[model samples]
Structures are given as C-alpha cells and as structure tokens.
Target: ASFRGVLTNGGRGGGGGGGALLRRSSSIRELPRRFSRQLSRRRSSLAESLPDTPAGWAASTAVLSSFALGYELRLQRSLTAPPLVFSQSNPRNDALRETLSRRRPGGRKGILTRDIKPSLWVGTRGTLSSAAAYALPHFGRKRRGECELNARLNFREVMTMGRDGASVGIDWEVPPEKYDSSLCRRKTSEERQSEILEGPIRKPVVLILHGINNDASFGYVRSLMRACTDRGWIAAGYNFRGCGGVPLTTPRGYTGSYTGDIRDAVQQICDRTASPSVPVFLVGNSLGANLITKYLGEEGYSGTLPPNVAGGVSLGNPLHIHSGNMSFPWAQVLGLGVRKSLFLTRDKWSQMTCRNFRAAFLKALLVCQTIGSVDDTLAPYLIRNDPVYPFAVTVGYPDAGEQYWDDASSYKYVQHVSVPLLKVTAQDDFLVYGSSLRKMSHCLECPNVTVVKTRCGGHLGWQESPPEEQREGEGRGFGTSSWADAAAADFIEAIIESRRKSDKEEEAIKKAREEEVEAEVAAARRRRKEEEREGGGRGDDDDDDDAGNAHMERRSTSEREGYIAARVAAAAAARREADEIRSRL
Candidate 1:
C-alpha cells in the first residue's frame, strides 16, 4: 500500500518519472540497492539527532548534566592528580630535565605522575585546600606553641645592610646544641650592624623569604628552617625591613616592589661567607615568592645575579597583583589580613613627620575594603614623600595603585629570568587568577624557568595525603609537611649535585690539558738536546746556538702565557659588550 502511494505521487509529478520509479523499484530487489537505501536512512537519522546550533548544544549539555553527579562521584573515588610542568624547548633545560629524572626513577616524570596527589578531603578546590594546609597545622595550642617557641629559641636575629637609614633583618636558625654566645651580638651605638660568619658555609645556604606581614616567627618559616637544617644546610629567613621584630629606622617601610633589599642581602651573604663557591638558594613563599621572582627577573635581565646563586624556588606566588586584587571575596579577605598586619604595627607610623600622612594611613586602615583600595589609598603618598629612598618625578615611579600593581607583578618580568627557577603554583591558589596563570605559562619563554601547576594546592599550601606506610604510625598524619618543601629541597640538592659533577669534569679536563702541555715541553727539550749532541765540536757557534735556543724557549713560554691571557681577556670583554647590547636593545 505504501509502495502504491509512492508510485501514484511520482506518476502525478511527471510522465516519465513514474516509469523511472517503477524501474528503480524493480532494481530494489537486488541486495546492493536494498543496503544503500538502509544506509541512507541511518545517516539521515544521525544527521537529525546531532546538534548543529547553539540551542541544540545547550540541550545536549543539559542532558549530560543529568548524570554529571554520578560521574563526579566516580572521579572522586579514582583520583590521580599530577602537576603540569611547563618549560621552553631549549638546550639549557637539559640539566633541569636530568635533575627531574634523578628525583624520579626511570625517565623524567611528566604531567601524568601520581606522586603529588592532593588530600581527598580538600580535593582540587582552592579555598578548602589553602585553609586546610595553612591553618589546620596550627590549630592546637601544643603545636602552635611549639612552633612559636622554636622560632624564638633557635632563630638569632642578624642585621644586614639594606637601603640608606634602614637595615634588613635575617633570622638565622641555629640548633640549641650548636648555639654559640659569641655569635649573638648585643645592641651597639651603630644603627646598622654587619653580619660576620666564622668561616665559609660549606653546605648550601637556603635563604627563606616569608609572606607579607609574616616573618621568621611564623610556623611555616620554622618548618622550612627545620627542613633545611635536616639536610645539613644553613637556613636563614630574610626579614623584610620593619619585620622580624626589627623596628624601622627610616620612615619608609618594606614594600613588595623593592628589589634593592634582596640584592643587598645576596651581596652581604656572599661577602661574609668569603668563599666564592658557596651556593645560596632563594626560596620564597606566598608574597615573598612574588618578590623573589621580580628580583630574579631583574637581575637575570641585567645579567647581574652573582655566581654563587645556584637557583631559586617560588611557592604559591601571586604573579599578578592587580588581577588578583580584582578577584571576588578572596580579595577582600586578603585585604583584611593586610590591614590587620598594619594594625599590629600601627605604632611605626608615629615617625611620619607629616600629620596628614599619619592620618591618611589610619583612615586607609579603617576604610579600605580591598587590597587594591589600600594600595591606592596609601602607596602614592608613601612613595612620593619617603626621604631615604627618593623617587624622582621624572623617573616614572608608580604614583597610582594600579601602576604599582602592574610594576610589582612578577609575570611582567618572568620572561627575562635567565637562571634556573622553579615556579610552583596550584590551580586552587585563590590569590592567583586563572588568566594570570595562563599568561604565566605563555610568558615563560626562558628555558631556565620550570613551572609546576598542580591540580590542588592552595596558596602556600601543598599538603598531601599520607602514604600507606606513614598512615599507620602514631605521629604520622596530614599537614605534617608540604610536598612543596620536599620538591624545593630536591630541586636545590639536584642543582648542587649537578654543579659538583660539572666542577669535577672541568678539573679532569684541565688536568688532561696540563699533562699534554708538559709532554710537549719535554719532547721539545729532548729534541734540542739531541741536536746539540749531533753537532760535534765545542765551538763559539755551538755555544751561541745553545744560548739562542734557550732564549727562544723562554720567549716561547712567555708568548704562550700572554696569548692565553689575551684570549681570556677578550672573551670577558666580548661578554660584557654583548650584555650591554642586549640591555640597550
């Protein structure tokens, strides 16, 4: 009945069409025709079912969302998160690759490694992870008190040279058993005190920089110190100006934008150590991470970081301050923290000679609701009026909060960093913006910079779940230590080991070259002696020949030394010239 209806419709359309349809219908008896008709119907059905419009896409998404909860539950049950490592393709990264490989057996661990799984409770949420990792450790009185006591008893405050009229404080952690009375200095008449080391620090010196408004007194800093000490390395926390119980001598206080203090600190550490080969590694946490990144970038761009600096590690750095300040709820929360820190040090503002400045500072503390607002309210006035560190109007020092944030942003300068740097950030770091992180991965053009973006680590919080072996122990639990600490330690240790290996290889090559030169000198002398013996008769000519040959040998040795020296000097000069050109360009 359906075939007769189709034929009637075709016959009504045209005269020959109905005859052609009849012929085709007869051919439908064949297997190929039947199969083709079925295939055409299936494709037509698929084409109708699939989405090709925005509305259709939304409908399809809604259909998927119905079972998303079930999928999420299954995902939670089988969680295996690893960090995403980003680095440029260049020959300079071979050492970094080898370092990573050494840390993990077999080949270098990639983005799929399951070693850095986040705590199940925290999952990959930024706020939860951060709060748990940073706050949970100090919840109990016993734990908190112990950390505070350790900070008080072990860390010795040493003043180092900084900007004019102000000095930077360094809290050096020395165990109670190793404490020497001679190392501690009483208050002297001099405003700035110099740090004197007994001898070169043979092991690596890890200089830790604490976050904003925090100092060596913080529990995390104490933990870091312990970690460094456990590795038999010297640990010191760099207290920003007016931090670490150090009162501000100058009216100006420490700001995150200042790189001068870090440079001065590195210079002092190197000079006091007296050993050029001593390794100094910088590890900055939270705000300190941003500061260290900026400092390293500036130094790397200028080609001025000292030879003693092995590398640097930045933990939970807020790369873009302006963008971060604009983020919801978190920005206001961070601002309140900063305001509280200022409130704690409210007495320091008494030194301001201008009544208006002091009043503005107090007002800003009271009224500012966000970090951006606080900076906008006070930074301009502070920078313009500071006596010790003068910023000329023409020099383009940031006068507005936005300008200051842009200048202070580490991402702006990260591309220029030429040294080995490990940037560890988590997807859950509320202080960092998603856009800023994406920009960071793109901006890191230098091969020396290795970025580790983990699935879940809150700001300065990299707490991992305990392994099976440690889970059963009495003292073992979560929040005991951070994966970041171990990673940073491994990175620094790997660099040190690589450096030692390189030095040994260089020494071996130098020795071989010296031996080759000595052999050549011996052969020349032997040839000359044989020539002297072959020339019979003890005559004046023979004596003159011997004297001339001796003179030639002396001249040859001096010429060789001069040639080598000239080559070295030329190489140095060329390097300086290249640096100047690069800087100018």
Candidate 2:
C-alpha cells in the first residue's frame, strides 16, 4: 500500500542532512519568510472575500477537495466551522485542516485515547487538584506541544526511550464508516458462532493506537504498524466514531472514554482468527495510552480476557487522569483498545444529542486556544456537544446519574490487577509529566506493572529521534528509542509463563487435597474395622491390656501411613511443577 510518488530530495527520508535543508528551504520558499512577518501584521479577514458561514465554508471545502488525496487522507469541511473563504494555502489553516484530517474517518486519530483530567491527593487522601486548588489542572507542563520523529526506513517505525527498557512501533487504525446498532448486533451475533475476518492482515496481530487529533496512520502509529507487520506481527488500527464516518447516534463526538471495546475487539480476534499460539499485544500512545491504562486497570482480575489477549504495552500512559486535561505547557514531555465497547462511542457529533452532551463531545474535538479564555475554550464544548462523570465515587454508566469513572480510572484498579503491563514515557512530555509517570511506579506495587520513563519522548509524541537524525532539524532533534516491541514481546512472554505457573500451582493444590482426603478415609476404615473387632466398642471396659495395646499400635501405624501419603503427594507436586517450569523456560 505504499504510494509511488517520487519524493523530492530531502533529509527526512535519509538524504542525510538533505531533509533538513529541504525543510528549511521549503519553509523559506513557502510564501517567503519576509511575507510571514509582514503578512501577520497585515491581516485579512475571510469576510473580505466571502461571508463566514456554512455555505461559504462548504464552497471552500469543495475547492480543496479537488486536490489529490493521500491513501488515508481526504478533504472536508469542519463541522464546527461555517461556510467561509477557507483555503489549504493558509499556514494556520493547513495546520488546522491537518489536525481535523487526523481525526477523520478510515485513518488518522485514535478513538480510545483518554480524556478528562482530575488529580487526587497523594497521601492525605483527597484529589490533588482540590488540595492544590489548581483551577486548570495543568501540573507537568512542557514547552513543546507537538513532536515529530523521522522514522528509520528499515524499521519503518518510531523509537522512544523508556524507564527500564526501550520500546518502539508504529500504531495506526482507520475508523469504520457507518456504525448502525443493527449491524453491530448482527455482527456481534455472528461473532458468537465464529466468523473469519477477511483482510490483508496475515501475520500475528499487534494492535496499535494513536492519540488526540491524530488517526491510526499518524506518523508514530504508521511507523510502528509497518515495523511490527514487517517483523511478522499482524497490525491493525481502529478509529473512534464520527471521525471515520462510523456515525454516532449520540450527538456528541468521540471523547477518550475507557470503554471495554478493546477487550471485545480482542475477543473478536480470538474468536475469528486461527493463528495458534500467536500473541496479541496491545499498544497505545498519548491519550490512547491513558485510555488503555484505565481499561487495563479496570480489567483487574475481573475484566473478561480475550482468548489471545496475551498482554499489553503502553507508551506514556498518562495516569494523571485529572491533570492530563491541560495542554502541555510547552516543552514538558511524557508517555486498545475492544469492540463491545466500540458501539457505545464516536469521533464527531451528528448534531442530534442533548446540549450538555454535545458540549462534551465538541470539547474533545476542539483543541484549546489560550488566546481564547478557558471559558471560551470550553464554550465550544459546552455549547457544541456534551461530555462527564462523578468525583470520588465510581464512574456511573453514561447517560445515567453516575458515570463509570470510579470503576474505570486506572488508579482505582491498579492494585486489583492480574495482568502484566509495561509503560514507556518521555520525561519532557507536557501531556504526561515525568513526575506523574514516575509516581505511577509507586502506585503499582505489583511487579507486573513496569513504568519506564526517558529524559525525552514528550507526551506520546516521543519526538527524540536517533542521534544522526537528532542533528537534523528542530522537530527532528528529539531522539526517541524504540520501546514498543521489546515491552510488548516481553509482556506477552511473561503472561504466557505466568499462566503456566498458575495452572501448575492449581494442579499441585488439587493433588495435595486429594491425598489428604484419601489418607483420612483409610484411617477411618481401619478405625471402623477395629471397632467391629472390639464388638463395636460397646463394652468400653473391654479395652483392657490387649485391646489398649492393639489400639496404640494402630494409632502409631496410622500416623506413619499418613506421613508417607503426604510426602508422596508433595513429592509428586514438586516434580510436576519442576517439569512445568523447565518446559516453559
């Protein structure tokens, strides 16, 4: 599915420093740097040429749509914007369009990323924000908002540094168009019996998720997917509703809701696929990781296991639920999905939901503009669509009095978990502060949870590239290590081993109980026989000399037999365990 366009000479694609030169040249060439300075000073309004309304915006989109489209990209009008004299030629306009495009259908933005940030106090037992009186909930703020890492052609993925180990991958998924409940129900029923999912994916699946305003095909995801698939891991991506034309029945667009959809999708994979012993690993970036962390934590020991859901790998799982809501301050940096969960959510609103709900969805879609106040920033969300949950208590069901927050928040369930989780984060990630990422390590007392934070990788952007590439350009400088593959493979392997150990332990316990019961039964039989021999012991006075001697001997023999039985059972148990462990190793 690689596009065949001959790329112009650049350093980005490994033309050495050529890409950097080309980028600089392109920027300079694009509208002249002189114009950049002067143009801002002499601003022009869209109204100068056309009215800022829906019709005008539609006309503008019509013009832009005429241009060629990438395999994963298409031009369209912004639902929140009205018809206006918009042009792709506008620098800021292009950036906005690109952001929207990332959130589009069939490709781009991740649907399962986390949203909403709340901070609970560390030791005193209240939310940190409430104690700090942090109005905006921005704790770990950085300088850079976005990071771009040039992927190595051979690996075809992004690499980022982590705390204990380096992990890497490209994560991508296209949103599906049209999600009719009837269709999902039919599919769900079909899934029950068993159905083969037809697709180009033939390798073992390694699911990947992207972040806010970015689809599965975003740079990091694309690189990781290509990398994993090439290395024999089947790769797949998913999109939120609305963005991929899945169409949300609810008026609200996609927000980072920790639904069990990913778990369902994994189950679907197990039910539908036939790759025996193939490990299905989950990976998420940015907010996607946030959602994943919450999902995994909520899964605890009680979450349903997808047959092949061996393990999970998360990059920058911003566990600071309450604090991650703030856009990174600037330079600071940091760090699955399921299907039954998918039907409950979406990417864009259909303008049919209740006003409050509409505002929530819209807030998710629109990035904050500080030039505009928080009230103004939230205005689009408050008025555009709805969004929510309760504080202190477990999150209730959506559309109900209580949201499922209490049940879904990662912090709430980290201690009750049974699976292995690996997290990679950038130290400078503005979205997820390194301190917070580091603190997660403390919360997860179990050895199963591993949190790795690097000096960089900021906010799932993992901007740091390789040393050579880091020397190339501004955005290219941040060197990111490939932590996804190692973390993923390691986690899955650990799960396989853990499961085997559990099985062995259970078997040993069963054998020991069986031996205990048998020994007890045999002793009872001997005692009964002796009682009959002593005339059912009806004449107790008959237990004189000879009878007392016989009974004492029987008691001694019974103790010895019981000891032997217990020893044999224990020995058998130990042997079985040794065999199991040896085989796994």
Best by the TM-score measure: 1
Q: Where is model 1 more than 4 Å wrong at Cα?
A: 1-79, 90-92, 103-114, 136-153, 174-198, 323-325, 382-398, 433-435, 441-443, 468-480, 537-585
lDDT of 1: 0.66
RMSD of 1: 16.0
Candidate 2 has an lDDT of 0.42
Query: What's the true lDDT of residue 184 in model 1?
Result: 60
For residue 348, model 1's alpha carbon misses the true position, in angstroms, by: 3.1
Q: Write the per-residue lDDT of candidate 1 for residues 198-260, one digit (tens) a residue.
A: 444455778899887677667566656666665557788888877887876655566767676
Candidate 1 residue pairs in clash (backbone atoms < 3 Å): none
Native-to-model Cα distance after best TM-score fit, residue 457 in candidate 1, in Å: 1.0
lDDT by residue (1-585, candidate 2, tens digit) is: 112212345423555465566577777787677787677656654337765799988987877665433311221111111111112244333333333233323332311121111111111112221122111211211123211221211212222212112222332322111234534532232232122253323235667776654456455555455445333355666553333323343332334543434544555556545553455667777656766665555454333445556556677665554422444432122111211122234333434456765554345334333311222222233211111111111222442211322222355444434445666654445555644554574445644555554432334433212222211121211122233332344344345545566679899998996676556655655666577678845533343444545655676689799999999997787567446633532
Q: What's the TM-score of every candidate structure?
A: 0.70, 0.42
